[model samples]
Target: MSIVTTAQAVPSRLFAIYAALFESETGEIKDRIEAWATPPSLSGRGADDDGESTTTLFNNTLQEARRIGLVEDIDDKLRLTADARGGGKKVRDSEVYFLDYMRRTLFDPARALETQQSGFMIALTWFLSSSPLRPMNFSEPPQVGMRAQIGDHAPKTELTSLNRYQNFLYWARYLGFATIVGGRDADDQNARRVIPDPVRAIEGALPAVFAEGNDLPIEQFLTRLSGIFPVFEKGSVREDYEAMLLIPVPDPGQRLSITTSIALQRLADRQRIALTSLADAPTRILDFGSREGRVSHVALRA
Candidate 1:
């Protein structure tokens, strides 16, 4: 029905689909979409056929690709758009195009209240609002504690299953917004909790944020950044969530969420950016745990 129900909506499956059909050259019959996930040897059917399952996976993924505008069914043929041909001849190793397009389509503000993406936005916004030092247990649906937050603005059916939650985690990492950490070996997935560190996502948006110049004042940077991801503090998604809250968020007295601030600090540590303070200049505070600091300007270096 939606990506929330399409459990294997992972990037690798998307890449596999792109690699398989990007070369339709003339036209790829829509049915061929399933061939990508169903190899000849396993194509047998009727009884013990495992092929139907394979085809289902790609079909589900195809719907998502269609949803995100990466490819389309035109005149009964599958056509890869200019987006899929991004690398000129090869499938990109990075999901940059996929994610960028998703940001423009699936994650667009218009769909924020729909189940297709509202689930992700709700879960992510919750993660962003949380403290990085006290990571909330991903084992529980974030909305549990914040039931008051999404009390009723929730889409027709809230995406609340543990399985759908996993799908949320998958998309979050693929889109470069969140990460899971902790557990036995730190690699123990079942025990991992999602952390709101959109470092990579934020890092990629710097160029556009500083489009006119290499450096931008804090306010300008926040505007551009929030424009790219409206789920951030002071953004549309946050406003929507706040509007539904049974109790307003206790004023943090700062615009940046703790999780977002942690991400920016991580970016600074990576030398991908520079956060500077200037005398007599309007500034904003980045409250990352106990390391609170103010910045007047941001400069991109990497």
Candidate 2:
């Protein structure tokens, strides 16, 4: 007898559909359109039109889920694939637990950095990852004018945080995460729109990867950038103005990847939303929103 393992339940508003698909005696998942979606009762006042929309949402979710191997379609039947194990390990359980501990405890490494309130390390990590080297050289300062002077087309700057942000914007532009507008005034302050592609992709994908009830750290997303390039190791060169660590791009096309820009925008948006939501709560809190918004707005404008 096959031991029936309880499936790792899928989420989103489509959970009802998932439940229905799994509830049948044989727990089969796919069939003709009507099986999974019969319209929800529209009779009651304020009853949302969920029937058709839920199916559409489920269809999108299921297609992506299948693509990522969390589930599969066998003979047009959707079934929990045996391969759907532990959400595919983007951040391991230990890491998630550690993040939680850091958020709650005084000695958390995250708190150490948060207390400093400087994004220097984070920016450095990103810079090293995206560069040709794995470590920064403390011996010499980065050549700010090198890219233009050398006609290399790559930006070189000593402002690590800002440079890192620009690199991310470039990648995001390449990946269709956001669109860049060329026209701007002399001071360079103008509106830049962050297209919704990156947010849609993450909103669709993250739930499949993270465990139920687990909120992945925003820093965890930063780690994903490192996967494209390695930043930390001892032998990497360091000059006073810049550090030259040898980091290799695993995928050559990463130079063209704009996915990061989209993600960064989405991250900025979420932070804004969180702050706004917090403002509605019954507590006196410092308004960091204005400053953060201005900084992000300027970055995107660039």
Candidate 3:
């Protein structure tokens, strides 16, 4: 599987290719993609791929599109899948398709460890949900503070782990979940990376969290979100003939609650749903001032 690294505008460029193919009569896809790649406006904003030949980039994009099921080889010719064709009318539609496609394909646990893609997703989600206002340094590795916030169990020393976190932020920028602002001084290595609209990030991730026609209580939904990445106990367990004992585990419920609340508030701010306290009667509040009432439940609008 080809892992899309940081600083590459794979999604946009691929979408441009898909849209070009969808707009024209069927012919050699490579030739069409190569033509599309020649134009600066259609190619993408990434400077990293400038040195790469158009043919090389086209071949890489084609392979990735096939792997993600956006395109398929039919009778020795490359053709966009029906799903891709359905969303090919607009660039925004194509962008949405690419995100959903990558999410489903990359976030699977079976391939996550090998690909490190799932780790990136989880890290990006956490960053956006927890600290959207902060400016991040894209060139730097995952800081010790970030690792602590993510929990001590998170890998901090491994080169691959560090790369995964960095790549996660890079992917966020590529997908429009975040933005990268270049430093004013050409000599300065520090660039400001901001997630200006975390709500948009949540919107992209919502489909992964909820299924069509499925309604869940807010607590249950938050619990599900927290469990996206498994949290393991730090110590060992011992068993005897009569009893068994395991080391105590830290409670993550509070942290999950905070993260979930952030997501819910962002969604509400976007007018996705109205925030209201569930009331029992005209003059009575059933759960107000209670722990249960603190968490808001959402009802999807028609």
Candidate 4:
């Protein structure tokens, strides 16, 4: 699928809906859902031309939350599940646990691959990892011939992926990973640009890919890591000051291979976890190849 159209095809309000529910008191699920569905002028853009009202957004969010095991529907009342509540833990513990829960619920690649918007999710991952340092400009229309490089590759212009780039800005802002500066512009009715908040992304969304038990396969681990950190490139290039947006081109096979290797090493360096090979094979580095390879399994050190 082409990147541009994919962004427009799926618009997510899951985060907003979740935030509303998270902040509310624990009883009266029906009332809470109804109040959330009410169209507060500031909460969301009005209903779409296709009968997609605020109520529809809330309903979709509820269904998604339930599907991801974040909430339970009991006797017409909605409540956060034990996992969502962080197993009744203390505040900080609960926050971390819930952040991880949010990641699994909304951004898991396995689940995303099963949907129509899989391309959009992949595109989102690409943008986050590839452009972690670059801020996006949303005020002006996307310019043609703006260049960026991922890893060792030469810089390439973003002429082809303009829509996809814009879509990323919209989606990231929607999920609170990025915020629009100066509100909506008067000319195009879009934000001038967006400032990405890595702290917010980590605290709110990145933790979900990690688990305390059971080793994750390299592919799954990389997918989770990709969402946590942007791929680092050596030697900075001149920034494209004129471009109003940026989107990552798909990584070349070699670049992706190198990225995985780097991510594994970083994880090891931080002493946050342990990596092991499949079938008790011994290796220093985690190998992506060999179904029975060393880097195939990852888990928290403890």
Identify the leading candidate in terms of TM-score.
Answer: 1
What are the root-mean-square deviations of the candidates from the true structure over C-alphas? 3.9, 18.6, 8.4, 11.2
Write model 3 residue lDDT over 9-72, tens digit each, in one string.
Answer: 3556666666666654353455555665656554543434356655556667676666556677
Model 2's TM-score against the true structure: 0.24
Tell me which residue pairs clash in candidate 1: none
For candidate 1, write residues 45-112 as lDDT tens digits.
Answer: 42223234665666677887767556767788887677655544444443455555567655566754
**Which one wins by lDDT: 1 or 4?**
1
Sort all candidates by lDDT, best to worst. Answer: 1, 3, 4, 2
- Which pairs of residues clash in candidate 3, taking residues 3 or more apart in a chain or in different chains? none
* Model 3 segments more than 4 A misplaced: 6-9, 24-27, 38-50, 83-93, 107-119, 125-130, 143-167, 173-189, 204-216, 220-250, 254-260, 276-293, 300-302
* 2 versus 3: better lDDT goes to: 3
Model 1 TM: 0.82
lDDT of each: 0.69, 0.32, 0.48, 0.46
lDDT of 4 by residue, 1-302 (tens): 32134432223444444444455436346656657566476235557554556656565556655655666776867767665765453333344555556545445445444432334443343344433234566644333323333321212222245555666576555554556666665675755656543334433322455654456765565555555432212101111211123443233222333223444455566665666767754333422333222465667653
The most accurate candidate by lDDT is: 1
